[model samples]
Target: MDNRAIGRCLLFLGDVTEPGFAKTAFGLRDWARERCVGELRLPQATVSAGLPQLTCEQAAAQGASALVIGVAAPGGGIPDAWVPALAAALDAGLDIVSGMHVRLDALPALREAAARSGRRLVDVRTPPADIPIATGLPRSGRRILTVGTDCALGKKYTALALSRGLAARGADVSFRATGQTGIMIAGSGMPIDAVVSDFVAGAAEILSPAAAPGHVDVIEGQGSLFHPAFAGVSLGLLHGSQPDMFVVCHDPRRDHLLGYPASPLPSIETVIAQTIALGRVTNPAIHCVGVALNTGGMDAAVAEAEIAAYAARLPYPVADPMRGGPAFERLLDACQETS
Candidate 1:
């Protein structure tokens, strides 16, 4: 999506209790809050963006230009009840932006509303029609993917931090956003989860192509290999990115899948092994570089202690990029090592 096309936006939240699925709202709040004017929450939604709650009409009056469906809805399909609410936003002169699997144009309500209001229907999830299949050929340069034990556990944040850290060290590098929220925050990226199942890996290949031998691409990873709901996307991204090194990201507080409570989250060691075994299909030399813990709201001392505990046990660097210090510096140092 064109970055210029987006203006002050009003995010629409589905009844997603878990932060993992509703990352779009939270990511924008943390990264691009200026662009997020307000939020329209469904009655059933238990979570909040902590922004001024407003209706589409009220948001439009305040100069909101777009209504973003900010939740990764279960099954990726738009619920029938959301159609009318979305149409109302379009009717209020706000363009509709969604990264859901369903195309906004496909819904008659939204299609007709946009026609009447002369607004755009932006679907970031749709891939280009001419995308080629993944070749699995070795590419130049180096790549580091921030994989995780489950969804929304800091993969994108870790990748972004690493990219900035690498650039600060005078390395040629870029952040490759893969998921919907990451795509929105980066302003442009391949929606790896939205691609047709057969072309998912192909989409990833195009997302981060070959670069100079000295260049590094800090690729934001997708779902976990252990998540039954999104493991396919995770595997596709791993095979396509073909990273020389990967960081295992995890939220120590989470023990089970966000939505599927019965399914336990995989251990960091398990994730590291699974990533290597599966990623070998495209990049045989792939291995773990570090571990990034998501200690978002943890107390400073607690977070530091957690990092220290992990570092003492794991053979690799362990740190929270948000809680940057000597430990995080160590992780960045490991990531930049090409030899």
Candidate 2:
């Protein structure tokens, strides 16, 4: 069936302060616009003037064929307020749609409400993964190192290092496709597509009764949480498989002394906080492994030391996996315990 037939899609933006979410939404909007999906809406207060709507009546008046409700992280479960707001959308004869970030368990209740009101609803996450080789499903036994979105982000190199480092230590590791080119593998090399395909097949194998649980795999995420292009598929996939631990890569370039103009990247604290929040939202027990020290500085030692120190203060253990092999091993061991 041609699933592209979205009768109407109303985007309900959540009030996630994370930059990655905003970036992802913008990217989704652009992609949807190209596909002619539907109208996208954000809460008035959350966005700009004349865009606010306290009820579905306003949305309907604005010619919204579907109801998209924006929310912050669904705290304490689905908020009490969403129930009525959704009801109003149904009363207005509109389909109710939400982002994929919405908790999976909450869908039934929202669907029931939509059903009662004779309205349809769906989560418009990840755009249906039409990539020829991409299944958009979680694969088991694949040790994945998902990188945060944002260009020049060290996720690609970091994931590469982790995979190589693990392989050298006799741990079979697989790199998930981040849709990027020019990734180098230490051993027998394959394109990112083939690697992911193999990993998916391996995951299926692991799920079989004859398969074991010790297989390792890793995947990379494409955009920062706030980058409009950031669709957190890697994170979702990792959570689905309940990976041993999540290793976050950080970059430290101190151009502050050279009068470098401020870039709009989120502060390290913000990134870490959002990551933790995502971890809690997905799987709380997932260990957080930190890898820092990018060589993009005049004083590599100082930069590495500074970032290493900063990473140490966080809730997770921070180390230079490239340099501190022993520490990296400890982190890997910890991730395995949870797996």
Candidate 3:
């Protein structure tokens, strides 16, 4: 059967400590459920996609083609314990789809298993070999980049939702994926985080190339400008994309940077100022259109109140993309006003 016809596979949920890293599972569930057969979790997974549990052999028996690693590990390296389970999946007649920086075939056991079972190891994080340095040249088209106060807030979701909203208004818009999960859903994108440091800006420029003057490219963001470890990727993308406008994604519940207790998250105002200062290097007219709050799993009334408070004081529209209402509509309106 063709790969597309292979349908769902057993999504392998490993021991990913950070809840955000497990976002790949939820992304596939929401955007590409047709490609998911079931889920397979290791012993101590804290997060889940809320799918039926199934082993590799059982998933293959159900006509599942591949076992996709559903975690976007921070360092992009595979865990030592995961090798055995991946090898087992290969032996059970399931291909391995990994978006990690580490290639599956690099592991000796997985290599032998794939060779014996004739299964494939797909690596999606490979960057293009011909990527060149960013030119900083002028480009046409409107662009909205979803920035964040911290990593894994609501950048990708905001971009996707905003793109849909723009399309509903009959505007020419496209959601540009910049991470592994977004790429998986969109079918193609450069994994900005995996690209070489020297070429990340170039890769980002290629990811969302120049388009018609009226067209809009809603580029999904990665990492955070305040994040100590991953901020480099974010800056590269910001400068390369040359966004005309941006939306700052935030979660009010968390006061500090996730996983980095010492580094407190920056305020949305600071982020807006910093982005304008830095992004002007590429696009002098870059500005903030709105704010997208991550109010997922919050009480309806509480979420509304929280958004209302932000809207009352903030100069820009503040809304939760997942809970679109008046505030979100205002955000959409603000985006449309950007020239």
What digit string (tens of lDDT, one per residue) describes model 3 on residues 78-113?
Answer: 898788899899999998888888888889889999
Q: Which candidate number would show the highest lDDT if scored against the true structure?
A: 3
How far off is residue 274 in model 3, in Å? 1.2
How does model 1 fare in lDDT? Answer: 0.87
Ranking 1 against 3 by lDDT, winner: 3
Worst 10 residues of 1 by lDDT: 1-10
Q: For candidate 2, lDDT tens digit of each residue in 65-107? A: 6654433342323455456556656777777544434442365
Task: Provide the TM-score for each candidate, comma-separated.
Answer: 0.89, 0.44, 0.91
Q: What is the lDDT of residue 112 in candidate 3?
A: 95
Give the higher-TM-score candidate: 2 or 3: 3
- For all candidates, the clash counts are 0, 25, 2
Instruction: For each candidate in the order shown, give its overall lDDT on alpha carbons.
Output: 0.87, 0.46, 0.87
Ranking by lDDT: 3, 1, 2
Model 3 vs. true fold: TM: 0.91
Q: Lowest lDDT 10-mer window, candidate 3?
A: 1-10
Poorest stretch of ten by lDDT in candidate 2: 180-189
